[model samples]
Target: MFCSGCGQALAAGQPVCPQCGRPVAAPPPPAVPNLAFEVANYANRVRALSTVWFIYGGLSLALGIVGLAFANSFLNGGGFWMHGPWAHGNFPFGPGFGSAIIHFAWVMVVLRSGLALVAGWGLMERAPWGRVVAIVAAFLSILKIPLGTALAIWTLVTLLGYRNTSLYDQL
Candidate 1:
Protein backbone atom coordinates (compact mmCIF):
# COMPACT_ATOMS: atom_id res chain seq x y z
CA MET A 1 0.00 0.00 0.00
CA PHE A 2 1.01 3.65 -0.33
CA CYS A 3 1.82 5.82 2.67
CA SER A 4 -0.51 8.79 2.30
CA GLY A 5 1.48 11.27 4.41
CA CYS A 6 4.88 10.91 2.74
CA GLY A 7 4.00 9.26 -0.55
CA GLN A 8 6.11 6.22 0.34
CA ALA A 9 5.44 2.58 -0.47
CA LEU A 10 4.46 0.14 2.30
CA ALA A 11 3.89 -3.55 2.52
CA ALA A 12 0.25 -4.59 2.18
CA GLY A 13 -0.07 -5.77 5.81
CA GLN A 14 2.35 -3.32 7.41
CA PRO A 15 0.88 -0.91 9.93
CA VAL A 16 3.46 1.81 9.41
CA CYS A 17 5.76 3.24 6.81
CA PRO A 18 9.23 1.79 7.13
CA GLN A 19 10.98 4.62 5.30
CA CYS A 20 9.40 7.56 7.22
CA GLY A 21 8.61 5.59 10.38
CA ARG A 22 5.06 6.83 10.62
CA PRO A 23 1.90 4.95 11.32
CA VAL A 24 0.30 4.12 7.97
CA ALA A 25 -2.60 2.04 9.13
CA ALA A 26 -5.97 3.72 9.33
CA PRO A 27 -6.22 3.53 13.06
CA PRO A 28 -8.86 5.57 14.83
CA PRO A 29 -8.19 9.28 14.72
CA PRO A 30 -6.67 10.78 17.81
CA ALA A 31 -8.76 12.49 20.45
CA VAL A 32 -10.14 15.98 19.93
CA PRO A 33 -7.33 17.83 21.73
CA ASN A 34 -4.29 16.13 20.17
CA LEU A 35 -2.15 17.01 23.25
CA ALA A 36 0.30 19.28 21.51
CA PHE A 37 -2.40 21.43 19.98
CA GLU A 38 -4.24 21.56 23.26
CA VAL A 39 -1.18 22.81 25.10
CA ALA A 40 -0.41 25.37 22.45
CA ASN A 41 -3.97 26.57 22.20
CA TYR A 42 -4.33 26.90 25.95
CA ALA A 43 -1.08 28.78 26.23
CA ASN A 44 -2.20 31.12 23.50
CA ARG A 45 -5.51 31.78 25.23
CA VAL A 46 -3.73 32.51 28.50
CA ARG A 47 -1.46 34.97 26.81
CA ALA A 48 -4.31 36.75 25.11
CA LEU A 49 -6.24 36.97 28.36
CA SER A 50 -3.20 38.26 30.15
CA THR A 51 -2.85 41.07 27.69
CA VAL A 52 -6.46 42.03 28.11
CA TRP A 53 -6.15 41.91 31.88
CA PHE A 54 -3.17 44.25 31.89
CA ILE A 55 -4.77 46.73 29.57
CA TYR A 56 -7.99 46.99 31.52
CA GLY A 57 -6.35 46.53 34.87
CA GLY A 58 -4.11 49.47 34.25
CA LEU A 59 -7.10 51.67 33.47
CA SER A 60 -9.04 50.46 36.48
CA LEU A 61 -6.05 50.98 38.77
CA ALA A 62 -5.58 54.50 37.49
CA LEU A 63 -9.20 55.33 38.14
CA GLY A 64 -8.90 53.97 41.63
CA ILE A 65 -5.92 56.21 42.21
CA VAL A 66 -8.04 59.14 41.12
CA GLY A 67 -10.58 58.19 43.70
CA LEU A 68 -7.89 58.07 46.35
CA ALA A 69 -6.62 61.47 45.33
CA PHE A 70 -10.09 62.86 45.63
CA ALA A 71 -10.45 61.51 49.12
CA ASN A 72 -7.10 62.95 50.08
CA SER A 73 -8.14 66.41 48.92
CA PHE A 74 -10.98 66.36 51.45
CA LEU A 75 -8.42 66.19 54.28
CA ASN A 76 -7.03 69.67 53.52
CA GLY A 77 -10.02 71.17 51.81
CA GLY A 78 -10.96 70.34 48.22
CA GLY A 79 -8.32 71.28 45.63
CA PHE A 80 -7.66 69.75 42.22
CA TRP A 81 -8.81 66.38 43.47
CA MET A 82 -12.03 68.07 44.59
CA HIS A 83 -12.67 69.45 41.14
CA GLY A 84 -16.25 68.75 40.12
CA PRO A 85 -17.00 66.87 43.34
CA TRP A 86 -20.65 67.59 42.77
CA ALA A 87 -20.39 66.16 39.26
CA HIS A 88 -18.86 62.93 40.59
CA GLY A 89 -21.23 62.94 43.54
CA ASN A 90 -18.39 62.77 46.04
CA PHE A 91 -18.32 64.51 49.41
CA PRO A 92 -15.08 66.33 50.14
CA PHE A 93 -12.85 64.62 52.71
CA GLY A 94 -15.49 62.33 54.12
CA PRO A 95 -14.10 60.15 56.90
CA GLY A 96 -12.33 57.03 55.61
CA PHE A 97 -12.93 58.06 52.00
CA GLY A 98 -9.28 58.25 50.96
CA SER A 99 -8.36 54.87 52.37
CA ALA A 100 -11.48 53.32 50.98
CA ILE A 101 -10.85 54.60 47.46
CA ILE A 102 -7.26 53.48 47.49
CA HIS A 103 -8.18 50.04 48.73
CA PHE A 104 -10.93 49.66 46.18
CA ALA A 105 -8.64 50.52 43.28
CA TRP A 106 -5.89 48.25 44.49
CA VAL A 107 -8.39 45.46 44.83
CA MET A 108 -9.46 45.86 41.20
CA VAL A 109 -5.88 45.63 40.01
CA VAL A 110 -5.25 42.58 42.13
CA LEU A 111 -8.41 40.87 41.03
CA ARG A 112 -7.73 41.18 37.31
CA SER A 113 -4.01 40.54 37.44
CA GLY A 114 -4.38 37.66 39.86
CA LEU A 115 -6.90 35.91 37.64
CA ALA A 116 -4.65 36.31 34.60
CA LEU A 117 -1.62 34.99 36.41
CA VAL A 118 -3.58 32.03 37.71
CA ALA A 119 -4.96 31.24 34.29
CA GLY A 120 -1.52 31.27 32.73
CA TRP A 121 -0.05 29.14 35.48
CA GLY A 122 -2.90 26.68 35.39
CA LEU A 123 -2.67 26.32 31.64
CA MET A 124 1.03 25.61 31.90
CA GLU A 125 0.24 22.85 34.37
CA ARG A 126 -2.44 21.42 32.06
CA ALA A 127 -5.24 21.96 34.52
CA PRO A 128 -8.60 20.88 33.11
CA TRP A 129 -10.29 23.98 34.50
CA GLY A 130 -7.89 26.47 33.03
CA ARG A 131 -9.77 26.85 29.78
CA VAL A 132 -13.06 27.21 31.58
CA VAL A 133 -11.60 29.88 33.81
CA ALA A 134 -10.14 31.70 30.85
CA ILE A 135 -13.44 31.73 29.02
CA VAL A 136 -15.32 32.96 32.06
CA ALA A 137 -12.77 35.64 32.77
CA ALA A 138 -12.81 36.75 29.17
CA PHE A 139 -16.58 37.09 29.30
CA LEU A 140 -16.48 39.08 32.53
CA SER A 141 -13.82 41.33 31.08
CA ILE A 142 -16.33 42.51 28.52
CA LEU A 143 -17.79 44.81 31.17
CA LYS A 144 -14.97 47.27 30.54
CA ILE A 145 -16.93 48.91 27.72
CA PRO A 146 -14.84 49.82 24.68
CA LEU A 147 -11.74 48.10 25.98
CA GLY A 148 -13.85 45.21 27.14
CA THR A 149 -15.37 44.98 23.67
CA ALA A 150 -11.93 44.67 22.22
CA LEU A 151 -11.02 42.00 24.74
CA ALA A 152 -14.20 40.06 24.07
CA ILE A 153 -13.60 40.19 20.34
CA TRP A 154 -10.05 39.01 20.67
CA THR A 155 -11.15 36.15 22.92
CA LEU A 156 -13.81 35.13 20.43
CA VAL A 157 -11.18 35.02 17.72
CA THR A 158 -9.00 32.78 19.82
CA LEU A 159 -11.87 30.43 20.58
CA LEU A 160 -12.87 30.28 16.94
CA GLY A 161 -9.34 29.57 15.88
CA TYR A 162 -9.08 26.72 18.34
CA ARG A 163 -12.42 25.24 17.27
CA ASN A 164 -14.89 23.24 19.36
CA THR A 165 -13.16 21.19 22.06
CA SER A 166 -13.45 20.29 25.73
CA LEU A 167 -12.05 22.29 28.63
CA TYR A 168 -9.54 19.50 29.26
CA ASP A 169 -8.34 19.55 25.67
CA GLN A 170 -7.83 23.27 25.91
CA LEU A 171 -5.26 22.87 28.69
Candidate 2:
Protein backbone atom coordinates (compact mmCIF):
# COMPACT_ATOMS: atom_id res chain seq x y z
CA MET A 1 0.00 0.00 0.00
CA PHE A 2 1.04 3.65 -0.46
CA CYS A 3 2.57 5.44 2.45
CA SER A 4 0.38 8.17 3.86
CA GLY A 5 3.27 10.33 4.96
CA CYS A 6 5.60 10.37 1.95
CA GLY A 7 3.61 8.39 -0.58
CA GLN A 8 6.50 6.01 -1.08
CA ALA A 9 5.45 2.48 -1.86
CA LEU A 10 6.10 0.19 1.08
CA ALA A 11 7.73 -3.21 0.66
CA ALA A 12 5.80 -6.33 1.40
CA GLY A 13 5.64 -7.38 5.11
CA GLN A 14 7.21 -4.17 6.23
CA PRO A 15 6.06 -2.67 9.53
CA VAL A 16 7.36 0.87 9.13
CA CYS A 17 7.58 3.33 6.30
CA PRO A 18 10.86 3.08 4.45
CA GLN A 19 10.79 6.76 3.53
CA CYS A 20 9.24 8.49 6.50
CA GLY A 21 10.11 5.87 9.14
CA ARG A 22 6.62 6.10 10.58
CA PRO A 23 4.58 3.20 11.82
CA VAL A 24 2.56 1.53 9.13
CA ALA A 25 -0.94 0.18 9.50
CA ALA A 26 0.03 -3.12 7.93
CA PRO A 27 2.36 -4.69 5.40
CA PRO A 28 2.64 -2.75 2.12
CA PRO A 29 2.35 -3.73 -1.51
CA PRO A 30 5.26 -3.82 -3.95
CA ALA A 31 7.04 -0.60 -4.91
CA VAL A 32 5.74 1.00 -8.05
CA PRO A 33 6.43 3.58 -10.82
CA ASN A 34 6.21 6.49 -8.42
CA LEU A 35 9.94 6.06 -8.07
CA ALA A 36 10.26 6.70 -11.74
CA PHE A 37 8.05 9.76 -11.45
CA GLU A 38 10.03 11.02 -8.51
CA VAL A 39 13.26 10.82 -10.41
CA ALA A 40 11.72 12.48 -13.41
CA ASN A 41 10.30 15.24 -11.29
CA TYR A 42 13.65 15.90 -9.70
CA ALA A 43 15.22 16.02 -13.12
CA ASN A 44 12.68 18.53 -14.27
CA ARG A 45 13.42 20.71 -11.23
CA VAL A 46 17.10 20.55 -12.07
CA ARG A 47 16.42 21.76 -15.56
CA ALA A 48 14.37 24.64 -14.23
CA LEU A 49 17.05 25.46 -11.67
CA SER A 50 19.68 25.36 -14.37
CA THR A 51 17.96 28.09 -16.28
CA VAL A 52 17.57 30.19 -13.12
CA TRP A 53 21.17 29.70 -12.08
CA PHE A 54 22.55 30.66 -15.45
CA ILE A 55 20.45 33.77 -15.53
CA TYR A 56 21.28 34.83 -11.99
CA GLY A 57 24.90 33.87 -12.36
CA GLY A 58 25.17 36.10 -15.35
CA LEU A 59 23.44 38.94 -13.57
CA SER A 60 25.58 38.52 -10.49
CA LEU A 61 28.70 38.53 -12.60
CA ALA A 62 27.64 41.69 -14.37
CA LEU A 63 26.66 43.46 -11.18
CA GLY A 64 29.93 42.52 -9.58
CA ILE A 65 31.81 43.79 -12.59
CA VAL A 66 29.97 47.06 -12.50
CA GLY A 67 30.38 47.43 -8.77
CA LEU A 68 34.09 46.96 -9.12
CA ALA A 69 34.57 49.07 -12.20
CA PHE A 70 32.66 52.02 -10.85
CA ALA A 71 33.45 51.56 -7.24
CA ASN A 72 34.04 55.26 -6.79
CA SER A 73 30.82 56.31 -8.42
CA PHE A 74 28.75 53.94 -6.33
CA LEU A 75 30.91 54.62 -3.33
CA ASN A 76 29.00 55.47 -0.19
CA GLY A 77 32.28 55.41 1.77
CA GLY A 78 33.15 51.86 0.75
CA GLY A 79 35.64 51.44 -2.05
CA PHE A 80 36.74 48.64 -4.31
CA TRP A 81 39.47 47.62 -1.91
CA MET A 82 37.40 47.94 1.26
CA HIS A 83 33.99 46.78 2.41
CA GLY A 84 32.03 48.05 5.37
CA PRO A 85 29.83 45.82 7.45
CA TRP A 86 26.36 45.23 5.95
CA ALA A 87 27.25 45.63 2.31
CA HIS A 88 23.66 45.99 1.26
CA GLY A 89 23.11 47.72 4.55
CA ASN A 90 23.65 51.40 5.06
CA PHE A 91 27.34 52.11 5.33
CA PRO A 92 29.95 54.47 4.08
CA PHE A 93 31.37 52.95 0.92
CA GLY A 94 31.96 53.18 -2.80
CA PRO A 95 30.42 50.73 -5.24
CA GLY A 96 33.38 48.49 -4.54
CA PHE A 97 37.19 48.49 -4.41
CA GLY A 98 38.07 48.23 -8.07
CA SER A 99 38.25 45.90 -11.03
CA ALA A 100 40.03 43.28 -8.95
CA ILE A 101 37.19 43.16 -6.49
CA ILE A 102 34.77 42.84 -9.36
CA HIS A 103 36.79 39.95 -10.67
CA PHE A 104 36.50 38.17 -7.34
CA ALA A 105 32.74 38.66 -7.26
CA TRP A 106 32.29 37.43 -10.81
CA VAL A 107 34.41 34.40 -10.06
CA MET A 108 31.94 33.37 -7.41
CA VAL A 109 29.10 33.88 -9.84
CA VAL A 110 30.87 31.76 -12.43
CA LEU A 111 31.19 28.93 -9.98
CA ARG A 112 27.47 29.02 -9.31
CA SER A 113 26.86 29.06 -13.04
CA GLY A 114 29.03 26.01 -13.50
CA LEU A 115 27.19 24.16 -10.75
CA ALA A 116 23.90 24.98 -12.42
CA LEU A 117 25.16 23.65 -15.72
CA VAL A 118 26.21 20.36 -14.18
CA ALA A 119 23.10 19.87 -12.06
CA GLY A 120 20.81 20.88 -14.90
CA TRP A 121 22.24 18.28 -17.22
CA GLY A 122 22.32 15.53 -14.61
CA LEU A 123 18.81 16.36 -13.46
CA MET A 124 17.48 16.24 -17.01
CA GLU A 125 18.65 12.65 -17.13
CA ARG A 126 17.16 11.92 -13.70
CA ALA A 127 20.56 10.93 -12.36
CA PRO A 128 20.30 9.33 -8.96
CA TRP A 129 22.42 12.06 -7.38
CA GLY A 130 20.54 15.01 -8.81
CA ARG A 131 18.54 15.38 -5.62
CA VAL A 132 21.72 15.59 -3.64
CA VAL A 133 23.04 18.19 -6.03
CA ALA A 134 19.92 20.26 -5.70
CA ILE A 135 20.04 20.09 -1.94
CA VAL A 136 23.68 21.07 -1.87
CA ALA A 137 23.22 23.82 -4.39
CA ALA A 138 20.28 25.19 -2.49
CA PHE A 139 22.38 25.36 0.63
CA LEU A 140 25.25 27.02 -1.16
CA SER A 141 22.95 29.58 -2.68
CA ILE A 142 21.92 30.64 0.79
CA LEU A 143 25.46 31.85 1.41
CA LYS A 144 25.50 34.17 -1.58
CA ILE A 145 24.29 37.05 0.61
CA PRO A 146 21.59 39.03 -1.16
CA LEU A 147 21.41 36.69 -4.10
CA GLY A 148 21.74 33.55 -2.04
CA THR A 149 19.18 34.70 0.47
CA ALA A 150 16.68 35.47 -2.23
CA LEU A 151 17.21 32.12 -3.95
CA ALA A 152 17.01 30.22 -0.72
CA ILE A 153 13.80 31.93 0.32
CA TRP A 154 12.12 31.29 -2.98
CA THR A 155 13.27 27.69 -3.09
CA LEU A 156 12.04 27.11 0.41
CA VAL A 157 8.65 28.44 -0.53
CA THR A 158 8.50 26.32 -3.65
CA LEU A 159 9.54 23.24 -1.71
CA LEU A 160 7.27 23.65 1.29
CA GLY A 161 4.17 25.58 0.31
CA TYR A 162 3.31 24.02 -3.00
CA ARG A 163 3.05 20.27 -2.76
CA ASN A 164 2.21 20.00 -6.44
CA THR A 165 5.58 21.49 -7.33
CA SER A 166 7.56 19.26 -5.00
CA LEU A 167 11.23 19.65 -5.93
CA TYR A 168 12.51 16.06 -5.79
CA ASP A 169 9.71 13.85 -4.53
CA GLN A 170 7.10 12.82 -7.06
CA LEU A 171 3.98 10.78 -7.53
Candidate 3:
Protein backbone atom coordinates (compact mmCIF):
# COMPACT_ATOMS: atom_id res chain seq x y z
CA MET A 1 0.00 0.00 0.00
CA PHE A 2 1.04 3.63 -0.60
CA CYS A 3 1.07 6.26 2.13
CA SER A 4 -1.56 8.97 1.50
CA GLY A 5 0.52 11.82 3.04
CA CYS A 6 3.96 10.97 1.60
CA GLY A 7 3.00 8.79 -1.38
CA GLN A 8 5.66 6.31 -0.30
CA ALA A 9 5.27 2.52 -0.49
CA LEU A 10 4.48 1.03 2.91
CA ALA A 11 4.52 -2.51 4.22
CA ALA A 12 1.15 -4.18 5.04
CA GLY A 13 -0.29 -3.43 8.53
CA GLN A 14 2.33 -0.71 9.18
CA PRO A 15 0.82 1.93 11.44
CA VAL A 16 3.12 4.77 10.42
CA CYS A 17 5.39 5.71 7.57
CA PRO A 18 9.03 5.15 8.57
CA GLN A 19 10.51 8.19 6.78
CA CYS A 20 7.62 10.75 6.98
CA GLY A 21 6.19 9.84 10.43
CA ARG A 22 2.67 9.90 8.91
CA PRO A 23 0.05 7.51 10.28
CA VAL A 24 -1.49 5.17 7.73
CA ALA A 25 -5.22 5.16 7.71
CA ALA A 26 -6.82 1.76 7.91
CA PRO A 27 -9.20 0.89 5.08
CA PRO A 28 -12.82 0.84 6.05
CA PRO A 29 -14.38 -2.58 6.55
CA PRO A 30 -16.75 -3.87 3.88
CA ALA A 31 -20.44 -3.48 4.53
CA VAL A 32 -21.16 -7.17 4.51
CA PRO A 33 -24.55 -8.60 5.43
CA ASN A 34 -25.98 -12.07 6.06
CA LEU A 35 -27.20 -12.33 2.52
CA ALA A 36 -27.15 -16.10 2.34
CA PHE A 37 -29.59 -16.45 5.25
CA GLU A 38 -31.89 -13.80 3.86
CA VAL A 39 -31.86 -15.39 0.43
CA ALA A 40 -32.69 -18.78 1.91
CA ASN A 41 -35.59 -17.32 3.85
CA TYR A 42 -36.97 -15.67 0.76
CA ALA A 43 -36.60 -18.88 -1.23
CA ASN A 44 -38.51 -20.85 1.38
CA ARG A 45 -41.30 -18.30 1.41
CA VAL A 46 -41.56 -18.42 -2.36
CA ARG A 47 -41.77 -22.20 -2.35
CA ALA A 48 -44.51 -22.14 0.23
CA LEU A 49 -46.44 -19.53 -1.71
CA SER A 50 -46.13 -21.61 -4.84
CA THR A 51 -47.49 -24.63 -3.03
CA VAL A 52 -50.42 -22.64 -1.73
CA TRP A 53 -51.17 -21.39 -5.20
CA PHE A 54 -51.20 -24.92 -6.50
CA ILE A 55 -53.62 -25.98 -3.80
CA TYR A 56 -55.87 -23.00 -4.42
CA GLY A 57 -55.83 -23.65 -8.15
CA GLY A 58 -56.72 -27.29 -7.67
CA LEU A 59 -59.61 -26.43 -5.39
CA SER A 60 -60.91 -23.81 -7.80
CA LEU A 61 -60.67 -26.28 -10.70
CA ALA A 62 -62.60 -28.86 -8.74
CA LEU A 63 -65.24 -26.33 -7.81
CA GLY A 64 -65.59 -25.32 -11.43
CA ILE A 65 -66.01 -28.89 -12.48
CA VAL A 66 -68.67 -29.43 -9.87
CA GLY A 67 -70.50 -26.26 -10.88
CA LEU A 68 -70.39 -27.25 -14.52
CA ALA A 69 -71.75 -30.65 -13.67
CA PHE A 70 -74.58 -29.08 -11.67
CA ALA A 71 -75.35 -26.71 -14.51
CA ASN A 72 -75.44 -29.57 -16.95
CA SER A 73 -77.78 -31.51 -14.72
CA PHE A 74 -80.05 -28.51 -14.28
CA LEU A 75 -80.25 -27.95 -18.01
CA ASN A 76 -80.91 -31.63 -18.67
CA GLY A 77 -84.23 -31.73 -16.78
CA GLY A 78 -82.68 -32.59 -13.42
CA GLY A 79 -81.91 -30.95 -10.05
CA PHE A 80 -83.91 -27.70 -9.64
CA TRP A 81 -85.89 -28.37 -12.76
CA MET A 82 -87.32 -31.56 -11.26
CA HIS A 83 -89.42 -29.61 -8.73
CA GLY A 84 -89.46 -25.93 -9.73
CA PRO A 85 -92.13 -24.29 -11.86
CA TRP A 86 -89.37 -23.77 -14.42
CA ALA A 87 -89.84 -27.44 -15.23
CA HIS A 88 -92.83 -26.43 -17.35
CA GLY A 89 -90.77 -23.76 -19.18
CA ASN A 90 -92.28 -20.96 -17.07
CA PHE A 91 -88.98 -19.28 -16.28
CA PRO A 92 -89.23 -15.51 -15.87
CA PHE A 93 -85.91 -14.85 -17.63
CA GLY A 94 -87.15 -16.70 -20.73
CA PRO A 95 -85.68 -19.89 -22.18
CA GLY A 96 -81.88 -20.41 -22.20
CA PHE A 97 -81.15 -17.28 -20.18
CA GLY A 98 -80.25 -19.27 -17.06
CA SER A 99 -78.15 -21.58 -19.16
CA ALA A 100 -76.22 -18.66 -20.57
CA ILE A 101 -75.59 -17.30 -17.09
CA ILE A 102 -74.40 -20.69 -15.89
CA HIS A 103 -72.08 -20.99 -18.87
CA PHE A 104 -70.57 -17.60 -18.21
CA ALA A 105 -70.04 -18.34 -14.54
CA TRP A 106 -68.35 -21.67 -15.24
CA VAL A 107 -66.14 -20.09 -17.88
CA MET A 108 -64.99 -17.44 -15.42
CA VAL A 109 -64.22 -20.07 -12.82
CA VAL A 110 -62.17 -22.07 -15.29
CA LEU A 111 -60.23 -19.02 -16.39
CA ARG A 112 -59.39 -18.00 -12.86
CA SER A 113 -58.31 -21.51 -12.00
CA GLY A 114 -56.15 -21.66 -15.09
CA LEU A 115 -54.42 -18.42 -14.19
CA ALA A 116 -53.72 -19.62 -10.66
CA LEU A 117 -52.26 -22.84 -11.96
CA VAL A 118 -50.04 -21.02 -14.40
CA ALA A 119 -48.80 -18.66 -11.69
CA GLY A 120 -48.00 -21.56 -9.39
CA TRP A 121 -46.17 -23.41 -12.14
CA GLY A 122 -44.13 -20.38 -13.03
CA LEU A 123 -43.12 -19.75 -9.45
CA MET A 124 -42.22 -23.35 -8.80
CA GLU A 125 -40.10 -23.44 -11.92
CA ARG A 126 -38.48 -20.09 -11.17
CA ALA A 127 -39.30 -18.83 -14.64
CA PRO A 128 -38.28 -15.34 -15.76
CA TRP A 129 -41.90 -14.20 -15.84
CA GLY A 130 -42.85 -15.98 -12.63
CA ARG A 131 -42.89 -12.96 -10.36
CA VAL A 132 -45.06 -10.89 -12.66
CA VAL A 133 -47.53 -13.69 -13.23
CA ALA A 134 -47.70 -14.42 -9.51
CA ILE A 135 -48.32 -10.77 -8.72
CA VAL A 136 -51.16 -10.61 -11.17
CA ALA A 137 -52.68 -13.79 -9.79
CA ALA A 138 -52.38 -12.51 -6.26
CA PHE A 139 -54.20 -9.33 -7.15
CA LEU A 140 -56.97 -11.23 -8.84
CA SER A 141 -57.30 -13.61 -5.88
CA ILE A 142 -57.52 -10.83 -3.32
CA LEU A 143 -61.29 -10.61 -3.56
CA LYS A 144 -61.88 -14.33 -3.31
CA ILE A 145 -62.31 -14.04 0.47
CA PRO A 146 -60.85 -16.17 3.32
CA LEU A 147 -58.18 -18.55 1.97
CA GLY A 148 -57.62 -16.72 -1.27
CA THR A 149 -57.35 -13.36 0.45
CA ALA A 150 -54.84 -14.72 2.90
CA LEU A 151 -52.76 -16.28 0.15
CA ALA A 152 -52.86 -13.09 -1.88
CA ILE A 153 -51.68 -11.00 1.03
CA TRP A 154 -48.88 -13.39 1.84
CA THR A 155 -47.82 -13.59 -1.77
CA LEU A 156 -47.80 -9.83 -2.20
CA VAL A 157 -45.82 -9.26 0.93
CA THR A 158 -43.24 -11.95 0.29
CA LEU A 159 -42.65 -11.09 -3.37
CA LEU A 160 -42.88 -7.30 -3.16
CA GLY A 161 -41.68 -6.48 0.32
CA TYR A 162 -38.42 -4.68 1.17
CA ARG A 163 -35.24 -6.16 -0.33
CA ASN A 164 -37.35 -8.64 -2.30
CA THR A 165 -36.52 -7.08 -5.66
CA SER A 166 -32.85 -7.88 -5.20
CA LEU A 167 -33.62 -11.27 -3.80
CA TYR A 168 -35.79 -12.15 -6.79
CA ASP A 169 -33.19 -10.86 -9.17
CA GLN A 170 -30.68 -13.21 -7.63
CA LEU A 171 -33.13 -16.09 -8.06
Task: Kindly list the per-residue Cα lDDT of model 2 for residues 25-107, writing each as its tens digit.
Answer: 75457877675676666556556665665566567657656665565344333445545563442544543444345566557
Worst 10 residues of 2 by lDDT: 86-95
Model 3 C-alpha lDDT per residue in residues 1-171, reported as the tens digit of each score: 998898999999999999899999979898776888778887888888889899999999998899788776676445543777666344678877667877788889988999999999988887869888999999998998998899899889888865887897777
Total backbone collisions for each predicted model: 1, 18, 0
Clashing pairs in 1: 74-93
Against the hidden reference, what TM-scores do the models get? 0.47, 0.41, 0.72
True-structure Cα RMSD, model 3:
6.7
Model 1 / residue 134 / CA error / Å: 1.1
Worst 10 residues of 3 by lDDT: 72-81
- lDDT assessment of candidate 3: 0.85
What's the residue-level lDDT of 132 in candidate 2? 56
Per-model CA lDDT versus the true structure: 0.62, 0.59, 0.85
Which candidate should be chosen as best, given TM-score against the real structure? 3
Candidates in order: C-alpha RMSD to true structure: 9.1, 15.0, 6.7
- Candidate 1 per-residue lDDT, tens place, 1-171, comes to 788889897777798887888887686677786768766666766566655555555666566568656654554345555566442335476645655765676676668756655555554455666556666766777776887677766755554443434434545
CA displacement after TM-score superposition, residue 153 of candidate 1 (Å): 2.9
